[model samples]
Target: MKLSGCNLPGITVMVFVMLSSSSTSAITNFNVLNFGAIPTGGTDSTDSFLKAWNAACGTADSTFIYVPKGRYLVGPLAFKGQCKSSQIIIRIDGTIVAPLDYGVLGKSNNWFSFEDVSGVSIIGRGTFDAKGPSLWACKASNSNSCPSGATTLSFTNSNNIRINGLTSLNSQMFHIVINGCQNVHLEGVKIIAAGNSPNTDGIHVQLSRNVEILSTSIKTGDDCISIGPGTENLWIEQITCGPGHGISIGSLAKDLKEEGVQNVTVKKTVFSNTQNGLRIKSWARPSNGYVQGVRFIDSVMRNVQNPIMIDQNYCPRNENCPGQVSGIKINDIVYEDIRGTSSTPIAIKFDCSDKNPCTGIKLQNVNLTYLNKAAQSFCSNVVGKAIDLVRPNSCL
Candidate 1:
């Protein structure tokens, strides 16, 4: 059976076709246009998209949801599953735009959320325009009535997922969030936002395992990639980041008993004019958390501030955890072949927790410079070793 058509203005249409007995023989396509979705981005297409998702998800056959070449205005959408079809693909050739007024999505949690899904692949050369400039202006003006912004895209409690070639622009908050998931891969993804936009992290991963982010370029205000607690076996490579905070692990130790982050590898990356190149930060609080078996290798930095850092007493603005010390144990970290130009005098800083000092930190073949001169290194409450021609005089 074949299904394809566009609906008339102000009319909602639902098309259904019976499949053959052997569903695997053919892949069915569910286009949102047939379900009354407006292509001009002037009207709400949330219901139309949801209907298409529901129909495609309910089928046991391999299904494809197609968003054709047009601009679609969508509201906050939650695509939940425990789907009947294990192999479902959503291909978008159009741009999905958020409401012109950021408040519509700002008050919500996520613009596009996928929860409890498995074996779903989203591949497209599409764009997600979140219209975040207004929200950033509001927050910049210290507007107390402003809502906490929503993430542009989020995947939670999902497994065997793949997101490829998707572009996110001007996100109100984070561009992509991977939480409570396993075996998720993101590749050839592009995230763009202003350099000073508040909290627009390119990607945030937490409570996930075996997640891979490869061949991605990010320009944002916050960390290009932020690794949170309970993330294990994450591999990030071939990434380009600039006009933002660089790759970071932690800001952990939030709770008294927190899950640790382990086995993360970030290599073959490049950073330019960023706030921090490679960092691991945590709040100064009494916690039973730890970070171990992390590696940062073969990365290049250009005019980045704090090329290498481990700030355990991360009490921003002296807010909470005043005078408190972090109890998080950070160990077994390696930085190899990191060559960089620092924007600051201190290229490397390791301010580890006094209660549980950092141990087994190794640096090899690190060359960093500041202002055409030799930079400096600072170490406090840490124990480590330097090998193979470290610059700025390793303070281990």
Candidate 2:
């Protein structure tokens, strides 16, 4: 069946088609152009994209919402779920540009949000072009006057989600966020922003479980991948990160009753010219949380500031941080086959909390150097074991 198209001034004509039978389910294509989206890069295509999404969500058959190759301007969009069909795909071969003005986007925290979705896949070579230079300038000039910028893409309360082969650039905030999601897979994703862009984390995972990030490249200002509270069974592999804060687990212990991150593994990653390579940080305050069973293996670092670190006294600049020791318990952490060159002399630092010290910290096959000299290791308030060819080894 051929679906009707709406006509708008300066908009191209497109058609949607669906073919179905009693024995066979049809794959419907819902092109955004048919819903009054003008890809001239001038008109706001938010409402038109929403119309296409609504149609795709209400269709009983499998649907593919297509965004053709063009520059389409859009604003904040939320694609809510409980879709009529189990399978929904968004195929983008175009660039979606955000508005330059943050005030026009309002206080929304996300540019594109997918919530309560299952069996959904967003796959393409498209780009999310977040025009964030103005916002960054606003933030750099005056901290308090800067609005809360929006993440480029967000998935909330979603399960069985797959995001692959997409590029997100110059996000005002985080490039992508996976929150309260399960069984999500992100592969071959590219995230890029200025190294000085404030708070532009590559990918932030929070309150999620069973997530896999594979074969990705990220360069941003903040952490390449930040695993926040309540994440479990996360496997990150084959990632390349640089000009950013490297992969990290938590700046936790800020909340009174924060959830713990457990059973996370990062392997076969490379960090170049980043602030930290593999770090687990927590605030220096009394909080109820724990991080356990985490592993970092087979990683390479080049000119990284801190290659392997565990800082329990994490306090950002300009804040009057407390002197109390962190209450979070860290245990059963392992770092193996981590060979790196550090920008600083102190490559391996385990500055754990004095009150609740770290336990069962194991290091194996770790070789770190600085400027053709052996790097140093600093350990305090931690008990651990090192085995098999540890270089520049220190007391643990």
Candidate 3:
């Protein structure tokens, strides 16, 4: 199937020629060195990287774009596709660094982007070092000239994608984003950033479906994994998160007309020294969004704050929509086999919206403590029940 071309930065046209299923084709290798990319980190390799991509994209055979072991400096890159081959692999064993001047890539939407691509896999133990501390410092100083930092990598309007064994360090914004895609899988990924770095979510998925994230470790400033509206059929397991905000859903209800998030499952995750664990939050404003059929199971938390939380009346900094109610409905959520130690006395908090209260919530075999003492549960505008063996006393 041929995908229509879209105008991409540094790209004139996209041509994809699909390979036949019955064909036995040899893998074509496109090495960045062959395209005049310098291995040293000082030189700009943007053009060389694009040249390699173009060469690989135009081929009918299976292709591999290889990045050898060295430090390489690159700027903003967009890999747009309707490629000739159905299978393209990007294997990287090098460290890719951004320019020292943060403004060079910080002002852009993303440092590296894949758009309108399909059947692609990125593998190997590569490191993406996006030197974001300068930008973070600029923002901390309250400089009006600071640009909104760019995401490290993003995939959009694509399908059948896989990312494995990649390390991202000090991303300017979100580390990895999956947007408007389907059948995406990410595993064995590591993300590291300062705990105070602003808006640096490890992974953010939205308007996507059938996504699976497994065996990932994240230590970031913001949510380790954030689920946005229109996300469905997501599975997250075996994740380790610390020095970050734990996995969250929503901050939804920003737009009046928004999509609902449903059928999400998070299991076997561990959190330590994090802000929150297993949270669902939405803005206190008018919206048509809803969250349903979500499950958080077999998770452990250590020294975390708000181990289980639902803040439908989330008004960050109490700036917008004071005294307003959230229109997003939340229901059919379950928490099972969650054991944790909370940093705060209140281990569980359900501060749902007064207008459209949360219902159909269930808790089973949950235990949480504060300073080795009995924790507490606070509830408001929520209707739920505890099945068995609930600590901190169920307030449903």
Predicted candidate 3 versus true structure: per-residue lDDT over 79-113, tens digit per residue: 99899988787877899999999999888999999
The alpha-carbon deviation from the true structure for residue 77 of candidate 1, after best TM-score superposition, in angstroms, is 0.7
lDDT score for candidate 1 against the true structure: 0.90
Residue 287 local lDDT, model 3:
87
* lDDT for position 5 in model 2: 17
Model 3 Cα RMSD, 1 decimal: 6.2
| Native-to-model Cα distance after best TM-score fit, residue 299 in candidate 3, in Å | 0.8
- Worst lDDT run of 10 residues, candidate 2, spans 5-14
TM-score of model number 2: 0.93
Badly placed stretches (over 4 Å) of model 3 are 1-25
Listed in order, each prediction's TM-score against the native is 0.93, 0.93, 0.93
* lDDT at position 112, candidate 1: 95
Candidate 1: list runs displaced more than 4 Å: 1-24
**Tens-digit lDDT track of model 2 for 1-396:** 111211211111111222223333477778899998888899999999999998989998888788989989999999999999787878788999988677655368899999898878887789999888788898889868778889999999998887888999999899999999988888889999999999999999999988889889999999999999999889999999999999999899888799999999899999999999999999988899999999899999999999999999998793888777899999999999999799999999999999999999999999999998988999999999999988778568
State how far residue 144 of model 1 sits from its true place (Å).
0.7
lDDT of 2 at 341: 97
Evaluate model 1: give its TM-score: 0.93
Tens digit of per-residue lDDT, candidate 1, span 1-396: 111111211111111221223344556778899999999999999999999999989998878888888999999999999889887878778999999988999999999999999978777789999999999999999989998999999999998887888899999999999999998878889999999999999999999988889889999999999999999889999999998999999779878898899998899999999999999999988889899999999999899998999999887677655578898899999999999799999999999988899999999999999999999999999899999999989999
